[model samples]
Target: MKSGSGLKDRLVAQARAEGFVDCRICRPWDVPQVPARLEAFLRAGYHGQMEWMAERTHWRGDPAKLWPEARSVIMLAESYTPEGDPTGILAHPDRGAISVYARNKDYHDLVKKRLKRLARWLIAEAGGEVKVFVDTAPVPEKALGHAAGLGWQGKHTNLVSRDWGNWAFLGSVFSTLELPADDVEVDHCGSCRACLDACPTDAFPAPYQLDARRCISYLTIEHKGPVEEELRGKLGNRIYGCDDCLAACPWNKFAVAASDMRYAARDDLNAPVLAELAALDDAAFRAKFSGSPIKRIGRDRFVRNVLYAIGNSGLTTLVPVAQALTDDPDPTVADAARWAAEQLS
Candidate 1:
């Protein structure tokens, strides 16, 4: 079996050929800082309704504990940078703005497939046992990515690379082989607050800290039931997830084109009309987002978000549409619809 620099070099080459933008390695226990930061965030209730985060603290805080046999972590980045300005749809309030990442196929499936293939290649070439992850588990991907020298966690608390920018999906392979670890990436945000300043709901309490309760993405995607009336207006036309902070980042200027065409925006999803999105019934919503990440939120929550967007749109033409849903079977959807109708009135 190949070992040392030769094996690591070939593994990186194989990853690039598999469509990953960058690949690096780190020791499983490299991130000593995660436990405390995670504890603080959970204590402050910043994770909001994501109780899973608190539930999996032991594993999430340390990769070494998650898999004791794993000696090295192979972290990889796959670019999904949008073709045009993702924020452009915000100008058209009558339209719903879906996050760039959710514009097409589910990234979890795409990135995981690639990670598994890479893991297979690693085992074949180096005879190492491996396990791959792509956001499904309680993995601290960003921390591992930083430790692997993929990028620094930016002020927005997302991984940001000087080479690939902030528009990438992170995946990891945990291996029993002790490959050489890379130097950690240092923070380059240095006084740049573009991400923090651009948040419509001021989700960031400070640099590198996010308050998910006030975050549009969290409200639209994770939060169950009706969002607080005070924050609903701030949601604007973003019906699925928010990207204002990501779009405003200066590092994105270096973002490479997505290697997979599946990541490209679908015309129907790019800037869908708010009224059309609000009209999605369960079957229609499932069919529309069949293979997409947006399907997980389900129709009721999705339409609830649409109603909030309709309220913020200031488009009185949508009043009837909102009124129609005021009697929706889903109480949350009904609440949102009534709120939207009142806002339009």
Candidate 2:
């Protein structure tokens, strides 16, 4: 039961039935250009505190090296496009704006389960060993997505599709069966700097290049301890990951609705009041964000982000909320609270 005739077509049809918006395949070694680009990004210290990215260069730079026996990389996209404009919450400084992807359940869990099911199906049909990966692995999903023709990497360094837009989550199924590969997707981002210009923190050094240290998403989620004073003010009300680049893309006009209802924005997280979020103790925060991706940052980091939002709120009423957290046990949260209190004062 090797990859016989009509197997590729059937695999794609099964993927669609499993709820993936788009599916394409590429050979494991197709992305020959990744090593140099990855080296350049790491050499420039653009990865910031994400040292794991620098550690696994051999595996991360080439999918072939990850599993030498794997033949085809099945790249799939699942859309999580928000029903309403995600950036609209930015105007309301009193509210904390969470990234569209993090507004509901964690995508890693959701996408991984789908990928596992697809991998099982592929194994049964083709009699080949299979491994599934969502985001946690060192796999270069965006590059493979481009190689597989699901989409091209846009100027913001995220995968953008003409058919499905830029709001899709990428997952891969690595298989030993030699499946036919799809045509590569060429770049369509011509002379557009909307994503670069839209960054509140000026994170993008140039088109298609991102400096994670200056990115609000990294500052809030990945970077530990107090964020640089200069950058904290630019975070605005974004308490989690930032979506300025994704929301600014004109390609989203063609974006389709997310297949799973679980990806839809939860009512509480959509535009949570900053003052209320700032008041969350450890237990309260855990209870509020149960099963959410935001919970992984823990109560301290989350509160630190909330205090920054409160400081930026300028509502004067939230000054007390920031003031109360000034003595928080977590030094980072305390520092953020003090900084936020001073901002509102």
Candidate 3:
């Protein structure tokens, strides 16, 4: 088996060849602070409806506890920087704003395939047991990414890289082979509260902390029922996920477009008209969002979000679109339609 600095160098080279922008290694025990932070977040009910965070606290909080046999954690960064300003779409009330990340193909599918390829190469070259994970697992990927020197968890609580900024997807590879860990990154967000102040719904309670319940991303994607009445107005035209805080990061000036074309924004999804999106039936919704991450939210919940955007749009032309769904089979969708109609009326 190839072991040492030579093998580590080869691993990084292979990762780049596989299209990862950055790669680094860290031990499973590197993120000792995760457990306490997670405990605080869960205790404060900041996780919102994500009960999975509490279900596997032991594994989610500590990587060493997740798999003791794993000697090293390989963190890979895949950049997906949008070609244009992701926040600009919010100004066009007639258009619905999808988060930059969801404007293309699902990162989970793309990143997972890349991780598996790296895992296969590692097994062949380093001859060790390997397990690959994207976002599906309970792994503390952002914490591990910081520990691996890929980036630090910025004030936004998202992994922010000096080289890639905050517009990257993270994947982890656990291995039995021992590898040299990189130096941990320190926070560089000195006196910069841009991300905190940029939030439309005031999701951040303080630097390095976030309240998911108040986040537009959580409201549009994760929250099951209709969103809180007060918060719905703050959503604006952002129907899928919100990127205001991410776009506010100053470090993005140094960021580059994704090397993978799959991450590029789709033409249809780029500032899609709210009336057209709200009119999509279940079949059309699935067909339009096929192979996209937005499909996970399903049509009913998706239309519910569009209704919120329509209400906030003030585009009286969308009244009939909202009126048509006033009797939607889904109660949440029906309630959203009524609310949107009231706003437009």
Candidate 4:
């Protein structure tokens, strides 16, 4: 414990070297002033089918509400910026455009592995117990990031890092350590309506609020049933998450170019042909997306996304691909296939 360097600075230097793009600290007592804003967002049903976001309002706004004994929050951001606009692949009607974030690997697993390593290092130095979380937990990571000066919450309601753009996935560790809190960031989204203007479904009801029910990412990946009919055609070649909002942000001009080789582009995922993807059976789907984040969404949902992409392909040639999936055992896939076939005809 006699390292002359202070603990927090030592930890920050260790984290940056461990492939984490940025790390900042916050006291556990300081959850953002997210109560009214979160309550309003929830009350308005902006979270859509993410029912859990509404179920745990207490902890979502205040870390103290989650674990009162926790003394510090170590917030981390990992950048997943792609080399180019992911939407460029959309013009190839025969291709499937997986969101840049999901193409290479499951971030939850990747981030958790690194966070645990960091936590272990913390324990070795400070002898404190710790718990870590990626997006799966109730921890308000975006709020913690804002408090720690990593970034501010942009109007799109995603944390915007000056160094990482909006392309970062957040993770946090709630620990018993009493690390000093870092500086906080202020919102700089002033007068920029780029995110609002770029949304295809007009999901933003106002500058800062999002209506997830109309969001393509929610509709394609999270929503279980048939996608809202009117919005299906707008989904385009996107078979997974939408990046329009993040890509349109002017602040991305200053975004860091990632050096993580693990996050580098994979040829198959960069722009997969829609016809080839739409025909995948369960076995083929598993093989193709083996290490990717999309695998967790499962074959049915993956095929459902493929059907949505096919419907938006504007090519009559893909009707056969839809016809092949119309009788899929998973009803969601079958339903989407029928919709796509009709759209093509």
TM-score of each: 0.99, 0.98, 0.98, 0.94
| Residue pairs whose backbone atoms clash in candidate 4 | 94-274, 95-274
lDDT of 4 by residue, 226-304 (tens): 7878898888888888888988898888777665666776888888888888778889989988988888888888889
User: What is the lDDT, from 0 to 100, of the residue 129 in candidate 1?
Assistant: 92
Candidate 1 local Cα displacement, residue 235, angstroms? 0.5
Q: Estimate candidate 1's alpha-carbon lDDT, on a 0 to 1 scale.
A: 0.93
Give candidate 3's error at residue 328 in angstroms: 0.8
Per-model RMSD to reference? 1.0, 1.0, 1.0, 2.1
TM-score of 1: 0.99
Candidate 1, which segments miss by more than 4 Å at Cα? none
Worst 10 residues of 3 by lDDT: 1-10
Q: How are the candidates ranked when ordered by TM-score, highest leading?
A: 1, 3, 2, 4
lDDT tens digits, residue span 109-145, model 2: 9999999998888878778898899989999999999
Q: How does model 4 fare in lDDT?
A: 0.85
Off by over 4 Å in 2: none
Give candidate 3's TM-score.
0.98
lDDT scores in order: 0.93, 0.92, 0.93, 0.85
Q: Cα RMSD for candidate 1?
A: 1.0
